[model samples]
Target chain A: MKIKLCLQKSTPRKYLFHFIADDRAWIDLLLSKVALIFVSIIILAALYHLAADAGRMNHDRQLDLIAQDFCSAINSAGKSSYETAGGNIYFFDAYNKYGNFGSGINASVSGEYVSVSFEENGRRYGSVKPLMYKTLPLSEDEVRGELMGAFSANGNISQPIPAFYGYTAVTEFLAALGTKEENLNTSMEVHIEKTLIYIHNLNGTEVKELEYILVHQ
Target chain B: MSTSLFISDEKAFMEPHNDIISTAMIVIGFVIFAAILSKTYLTYDDNSLSLENYRQAALIANDVVGYPAIQGSRQDLISAYALDSITMPAADREMHSDFFQRFSSNADFFVDVRTDDGSHAWIIDRYEASSHDGDIIAASVPVVIELGNNARCVPGTVTVRLRKNKWI
Candidate 1:
């Protein structure tokens, strides 16, 4: 009985240390799918934001066209042009001109919410009441103050000028613009590249006061 | 060396390792997918400055032309601005201290009115802006003013130019 010198173990400790590279649990698969869905959503959201930006840019361009036309029309307003009104409907002329602002888009005159002060007899930043002169021949400064008072609104009122000037086309477009409804969402703007004062008093003498020259000429 | 040693008796195992192939496929696939998706999605840049100033210029021009000069005393001509009154005969104290108040703004603006013929005519009925060096700001609208008396209303095409200051 010089029996068994070579013996082998049925289970080896080293084998337990071997890792199966291809094996994956079900939870791993589920997590991967969830992650994929989240990533997909993020990508799609980014794409959507890009598209919305383009749409917004295009809309603004269209508005610019309509607004420019409106400006021209308003600036050229004559004595009879019913600008800022199409038979009393506000922004009517503009609405009709651009084929009703290209469907679903409405042309409107929107106002701003401003915390304003009403003092100095409505000659400062008060309610834009009419600059009524019970007496004639007021000081130029007084008159200027009266008008500037209205222009001194808290927000920009330039947006409505082009439409008002374009649509009404009044003879004196500036002179015709009175009343709250007319001035709403609009402001009186003056850019003085040059100023001319004509003395037609006794002699037809024209005097001009030239301010600083513009860079662009 | 013996021939048996150089040439194996068993068939040569030519198939690639499945684990290695699978791992490579997953990594490459994920990379390709991510690249394509990113290319398709990410695209947003700022482009509001130019157009915005353009609109601002338009508003400023409108303000200059449409500013109300007088108040309630004359309803027949209550809310009239100097630009509009310029079309009429020269009046006394037409625009006073309020000139500074009305035109004062954070953004500097320049405005001028000229006839189509390029002669700075219409001295009696014109308002000119003071400056013109800014980005994307300037609006020139064509206007026709009826000068003289109603019996002799002369039609004139005037160009009103408005510009924002460069500093603004």
Candidate 2:
């Protein structure tokens, strides 16, 4: 009975082995191809994210440098204007220096700070530096009109306003004497002026005051 | 029979064991990559911060050297008389307050002016020993010191040291 069982099992086992051997190669190849594709996709996705993060970091560093440079320029111009007979004019080319990489770039000086901001990949990045000189606050419309008038007088209005030189109506040039614009790519003129203003004292006497005026041209 | 049973059991155990080992290897690789990336980022950040601090110190030094209040007959020239008056112990309080008013309120720094010969030296700000506890960034610029009314000018150096306070 044992010999009979062995003979019957051996015949079926040989056929089963042949059948499995025929199919196993195809199945293994298919599975390995699928796994390779999945791993490649994961690696590519990770690389893309790392590249994006590095780009963002680079943008932030550039923005910080622009802010520092603007502050240093303001300080130097203010110091020179304080001593010189006539005020100083500093030409800051934001777009050329730091705005080339990011979009919706804006620079402004409000109160005691000079700030630069931009947008990248649906995220906003900004940097600010403190100014050593004092500034007087003024309204946006007033500053815009003054800047327009100055540019017009200098024959700079013959060419169309550069894309980066102007801002939308809703955006306010909040800095009293600083420039404010969105999508900025043009150069800006910072005019530091030492002017005299008279104020009425509590005793009704006229007090002469020396004031530093910063204006965007 | 025992050998066949052991072989079948080994086949079942090896699959899950291999999977766990591969998964652990992937996790370890990711952890190492992340650690290296973070360390590189931190080092870059530290270097940039140091550069920024030095730049700030340099700006302050230049501004102090060109300040009109301390300037002599010409610009970029330090007046000996003014330095002498301001450095006096009796005038320290008023001078310190004046310097605070002159520079940005955010700046925590002091200025040092000294001749090349070490004959004269002056500290423009009220400096305390405690201020040295924090990280200090310093910058210096060449300047001309006016000794007297006879137009005797001596080369000097103006140094600005900025203190960076660490947040807890």
Candidate 3:
């Protein structure tokens, strides 16, 4: 009887072992759910980032187009039209004559800061006390240095011009600027009448200079 | 009586085995759940370089140029006025005012008038202005000068600010 019982047990246990009920169904289910959540979050985040990048690129493209349009106007106007109010050139006038800024980019303008200087005449009779202007987010050193050189230098300030940051729009005009020329016939005066215009780009990375001389023909 | 006692003992042993197996399954299930959660939470990629490049480009677009008009000095017009002073020069004054209006309409800016002693005063002016973009760093101011009687001159302090409006 003992030998027969051992043989039966061997066959029965082998079949049961092959079909054991130790399945990890619950563990696999939970792990899959958690993994799905993580992957979803990463996908969503990437999507958001891509959308933001697209918007920024669009904005930059618009600004670039506007800058180009402004440059064209300044160049065509012969620089003299822009030199009103020292260096202030009215955008309204430009627009009225040539339609709105071609790029359709919108911006608000405001004063950033102010400066004043006293100057003694150089080989001229009268002394001049001048007022200087600047936009916001600019350092004192940069503003002063550029103005000082521009005041003393001859035609068109030299290269390596100062760079500017911040501010949406910038303009310049001449309250008063003059030059004296002496000739063999007699002492001649070459007055630089009218205002000079400077248009600063939205990024402040570029400035368009417009020169204006009174038509003394 | 002996057979009845054997059956009762077998029942008690079977109950304990069932309890042990159930408890082990519950613990393993919880461990798997926890590992999955951690793997999802711990993964992240960095894109700081791209962010920095975009920021720099925006700054350049906003601050490439300086307002040269506001850079001029605003001192008393007595000396130059007296020398070239034509009594009742309303025409010239009107022309000058018109010029100023043209400059004023271009953009908004502050005009700082500084004295020799380093004491400074500023004026706020507005122009019809727009920007490509502006940033905190790489902003600058432009100073423009309008010479008097063609007499060379210099200002004490001149600076312009490029204000960048930040989103985010």
Best by lDDT: 2
Candidate 2 per-residue C-alpha lDDT over B118-141 given as tens digits, one digit per residue, 9 for 90 to 100:
998987665444344468889999
Scanning candidate 2 chain B in windows of ten residues, the lowest lDDT window is B10-19
What's the distance in Å from true for residue A125, model 3?
A: 56
TM-score of each: 0.30, 0.59, 0.27
CAPRI-style quality class for the chain A–B interface of candidate 2: incorrect
Model 3 chain A poorest ten-residue lDDT run? A123-132
Error of model 2, residue A90, in angstroms: 5.6
Q: Write the per-residue lDDT of candidate 1 for residues B1-168, one digit (tens) a residue.
A: 577864763322212233435555755676687667555534321133344455555655454444434322232222223434453233433353233222323334444455455533432222343323444345654544333334222223323333433331
Q: Chain B TM-score for each model?
A: 0.41, 0.73, 0.24
Can you write out model 3's per-residue Cα lDDT over B11-63, one digit (the tens) per residue?
A: 24244244445545655665575566445433411132223323332332222
Report how far off residue A82 is in candidate 1 (Å).
Answer: 18
Better by TM-score, candidate 3 or 1: 1
If both were scored by lDDT, which would come out higher, candidate 1 or candidate 2?
2
Candidate ordering by TM-score (highest first) = 2, 1, 3
Weakest ten-residue segment in model 1 chain A by summed lDDT: A208-217
Task: Tell me which of candidates 1 and 2 scores higher on DockQ.
Answer: 2
